[model samples]
Target: MTQVDKASRKPCIALMGEFSAGKSTLANLLIGSDPLPVQVIATQLPPVWISHGDAPAFRVDLDGNQFAIDLDNLAEAPLDETAYIKIFCDEELLLQCDLLDMPGISDPNMSSEVWQRMISKADGVLWCSHATQAWRQSEAAVWASLPPDLYQRSLLLLTRIDKITSERDRQKLIRRVRAETEGLFLQCLPISLLQATAEQDDYDVWLKSGAEDFAKHLVDLLHSLSEDGAVGPEGQSLPEAAKPLRISGLVAPDSAPAPPPAPAPQTAAPQIMPRRVRLSPSPQDRACARDGAPGRPS
Candidate 1:
């Protein structure tokens, strides 16, 4: 393919994981708004797909005919071999990329075969695994099977990390999880999706949630993956030394953070270190998440 042909094809990043692992939270952060519905909906429904769009939403059936989804009624939609429902949003961040928010791979009711269909189109994934139970044997097995190219583009997110509370415990858990899935993901990031959501506007919230580190890595990775060059197994340019483009975004997940960048022109400052996540529709999970809850703002 010509260099121009390759540059035109935008990368698609899928937010994938078990139910309630905070997949939607990461999506919301990128979209810079609460476009994707975050409810307590569990397994019995269809995929809540997202892409770049002008309107906040429209539901597309298995055949791709666009129809309005109440967004609220996703759980009631038919799921029997009807393909997946597409949810469209107009988030600006999508201008440079596509985000696929997928269904739970571990749901007993859903077949692995179903999620498999979506993998080929995905250039990368942000795999959300719960912090305490980070990488299960099942997750590892599946992640191991993905094309290595995807791994260079993917991020393994350890969600709900606030549970451990202790710095030592958190590091230990992160270390063990990475050791178990070594070479499977480009990088492993631990962040409290819940805290990030509740404290969306706070820089400290983003850093403390560990999202700052993840965001920096994401920007660097996406910039590298978007280029058109012979990719090496190391995820860099082959033969020629790869000088990955430095991508600037509204968010920066850094350690010794600086002032948040101003929106748009003035500074193109990183986004408000947004840490927002909406809860999915769940009976028991909701209770566990909120039992020790903080005031959840929009």
Candidate 2:
């Protein structure tokens, strides 16, 4: 085995979730460009590791053999032999961190080995769960097996919030998710990736879509992870204003409290803050939540 060098690595954030959980859309929103084709994303592929550079796209095999690959035809990479596809982009967001877009955890067609082998490469994770069926047992089980330190650095995202039509149900879902996942992540945010992508220039739409808050939180997470010395280059210290509130604890509660009944969603939009990435963006099912609410298995 060759020695692994950690002195010059940037923090890597992995985009992970069940199939169609908006992981690819989140990747596109962050990059501000569609590097991963929608058709390719819809198909099963190994982890696509994206970094900041102008290098040509390439594929690395399980045995560490490298070969150039056409970015236009990503579907040709052999799933059984390929380790990951290394793609470079000049996006500002990539300057701060590398994004590893992993295959869907729930895809029956793809073996877990494809993604499991890549988890060690991540400094943090953005676990996307579908709003209608958020935080299933399988997701929690997988998360429980990951590095415990990641709980402080990671986030739980409820994607496709627009599917829940009523404001009452939306707030109810968000609050419940936050409560249930209180100790598991930095924050649990709700977002509609499609809405954020479609209305990137609209400030109010960004706020209402939950993208604004997600962006700010994401930036903060990057800073926190970098400052905490998680594979960040030297001389990078935590800024005075960037002290994240989530890094102080790693204690998981014995049990999360049951979420209270639904409150009417706030009509006022959250204030927006500028972020490097335009697209920004958790929970379990329980009986308390109804009408497309998440209900954790009893």
Candidate 3:
């Protein structure tokens, strides 16, 4: 794609994991709204492509046809024929990027083809593995098949981290996943998605839940993709070489330096330099010049 085309299209981040890995919960937390139904019943639904807007919901069939669908009745969506469901919301996060909430890779009720079809559409992925059973062989097998380009932009999230109980165990799990999946993901983080979502009003709780680091990295990723002049390996832009923004306490600290000012706007279109004019002296003037006098030729 051309640079403009790549820049114009919002980066698509796919959320993939095993069953009940808290993918939906992370989606809800990042979006700051639950556009998709988060009930157990809705877990079995097809991939949901969420973008920014106030448009009504629709489902895309395998043949690339769109049909209007009701959000309340999404659980009834036909799994076999549907390619993916499209959801739009006026959330701030959606304004920066799109989120694809994919089904579990090992869902017995749903065919692997269901999510496999949608993987190509992702610019990045957040692969959620349950903290208790982090980075299983099955997860690794599937991740191995993905293109290397996606790996640079992708992340491995150990969800339900609160269940791990001990800091030592948590750190050990993080180290183990990082070692095993080295170069496969940008970073491996343990997160309590449930706590992050529940503690929306409490910054300290949110940070403790591991949402703060996740959010910072996420924003950096999106900003990199948006500002980079060229498309990155997976069509997402990699982070620029400059220093990253310093975030503090769930927001920018007052002491932090402000972002550089925008360039001054040009008030007028640039004027083309006039082509150099060669003025041939008029015949009379030429004669007078030859005569070395200021009057007409006598």
Say which prediction, candidate 1 or candidate 3, comes out ahead on lDDT: 3
> Candidate 3 lDDT, tens digit per residue, 1-298?
3445546477788999887777776676565555765344444789989887899999999999999998877877799999999989775556557889898898888899999988888778999999999999999999999878888888888888999889899899889999999999888988887675455445466567886667656656666556655343355554453223221112211122437656555996655432211111111111000101111100
Ranking by lDDT: 2, 3, 1
Index of the highest-TM-score prediction: 2
Q: lDDT of each structure?
A: 0.62, 0.71, 0.69
Q: At residue 180, give the lDDT of candidate 3.
A: 99
Off by over 4 Å in 1: 1-8, 38-40, 55-68, 200-205, 229-298
Writing each residue's lDDT as its tens digit, candidate 1 over 1-298 gives 3444434455667888887677766676556566534463333555556666765455555576666666666665666654566666664445445677777778887777666766776777999998888888878878777778777778899988999888999999999988987777889888876665455446567558775566567756665656543243333443322222221222422234457655577656645443322222221111111111221111
Return whichever of 1 and 2 wins on TM-score: 2
Alpha carbon lDDT at 48, candidate 2? 91
Off by over 4 Å in 2: 1-7, 230-298
Could you estimate the TM-score for every candidate?
Answer: 0.70, 0.76, 0.74
In terms of lDDT, the best-performing candidate is 2
> Which runs in model 3 stand beyond 4 Å of their true positions?
1-8, 38-43, 200-204, 228-298
